[model samples]
Target: MRRTQLRRWIVGAVAIAVSVLVFLVPFAFILITASKTTQGASLLGFSLPDKWVLWDNIVTVLSDRNGLLVRAFVNSIVLTVASVTIMVVLSAMVGYILSRRQSRWNGVITFFVLAGLIVPPAVVPTIWVLQRLGLFKTLPGLVLIEATFGLSFCILLFRAFVATIPRELDEAAVIDGAGPIRLFFRVVLPLLKPVIVTSIVVQSVAVFNDFANPLYFLPGDQNATVQLTLYNYAGGMAANQYNLLFADILLITIPPLIMYIFFNRQIVAGMTSGAVKG
Candidate 1:
């Protein structure tokens, strides 16, 4: 028993060390590079800089192109908030219905929802559809695209969580003269806090970090997002403003990092809370 215990302890220690290295190494490199001069950052070595220029890099990134970085921040925030809000509410309602209903069409709907996970989106076809709808190159169009791509996953998460909720709750709400909307808002939504928080954090991070969807669906200089600011700092083959690029990367990365740090426990609980049946 003692030998087995010692072996387990050694394994756990090694796993923890590996995990730390995996996260810390890249983050440390980014931090070091962000603190260097443009020439120093171009070297891309792991060594500490002789002269720290972290503040200068940040100022330059923020002030470039008459404050394009600020505009990108605003665009990213709007996109994330709008897309996530719509995705969560719609997915929750759909998931609840799918979880409770036993109709024939439910199976078909479920199949399609799951198919979204398996299938890749066709960009050209989507662009054509968007153009026909008069939504091409619009923020609302990008919001819809983000929501559609995320709906399947969010619905799956909510459906599993909703299954773990007892039907008695619904019956009791009905007995109290609650309608569908009222019941969902008052009883079901309150109970769904963990999963909701998980969805919000996960989807918010995904939308905020999204580069391709914004680039393809909402292409415009005025519509640039935080991720696109990287291009501004290091554009074309000749441009090599490594210091500003790293600084921009670090700034954009901090929000999601803080979100994960704060909501990590909730995310774990939300993911696992519905796994076991009572």
Candidate 2:
């Protein structure tokens, strides 16, 4: 008993140490650097600031270029909300259909869904399509891109979770004179709270932090997402404001961090929900 207890303690201690090193240490470095002067931040070592100027850095970053960061934040929020909403709704419906109906086309549909995850997006072709559709360099177009890229993964998650739901519920709903839409919306959707929350939280972070998609599909200072705001402090004619850059990173990082912290348990539950059953 003593030996087992000691082993458990050692394992726990190691896990804690690893977690601190991997996550907390880096976060601390970012925090410290963001609070430093430009010269101090340029050194980029993990140390406390001689004088905390975090508020000053944040103010400067927010006010830079007539408050580009503020506009970027609005763009990011809109992009994330729109794309994630589309992903959740579309993926949920597709997953439910796939779960309940096993047809000859199911295999083909699943194959394509899986391929979306496996296949690397053809950037030039995608751009050509966007241009042809007159959606090039638009926020709505980027929303579609984000939604499509995330769809496959979200579908898999929802499909697995949907399998855990019994067929009896559907039968009962149908017998109660509920139409297909009514059945799904009224009966099935409510019970999908856990997985829904999971998808929203997961995709929201992905869309909000997405840089490349917005860069390629949605250009212009007016359409800049928060991640693109990092460029305003770095490359091109931008100055060497390392402090403000780190400050921007920290600012943009907070939403996702808070999300993960609060919904940590729900994410675990949603991911593991259908594992045993399906």
lDDT of 2 by residue, 154-255 (tens): 999999999999999999999989999999999999998999999999999999998899888998999999999999777765566778889999999999
For model 1, residues 118-142, the per-residue Cα lDDT tens digits are: 9999999999999999999999999
The segments of candidate 2 whose C-alpha lies over 4 angstroms from its true place after superposition are 236-239
- CA lDDT, every prediction? 0.92, 0.93
Best candidate according to lDDT: 2
Give the least accurate 10-residue stretch of model 2, judged by summed lDDT.
232-241
Q: Model 2 shows how many backbone clashes?
A: 0
Q: Local error of candidate 1 at 6, Å?
A: 1.9
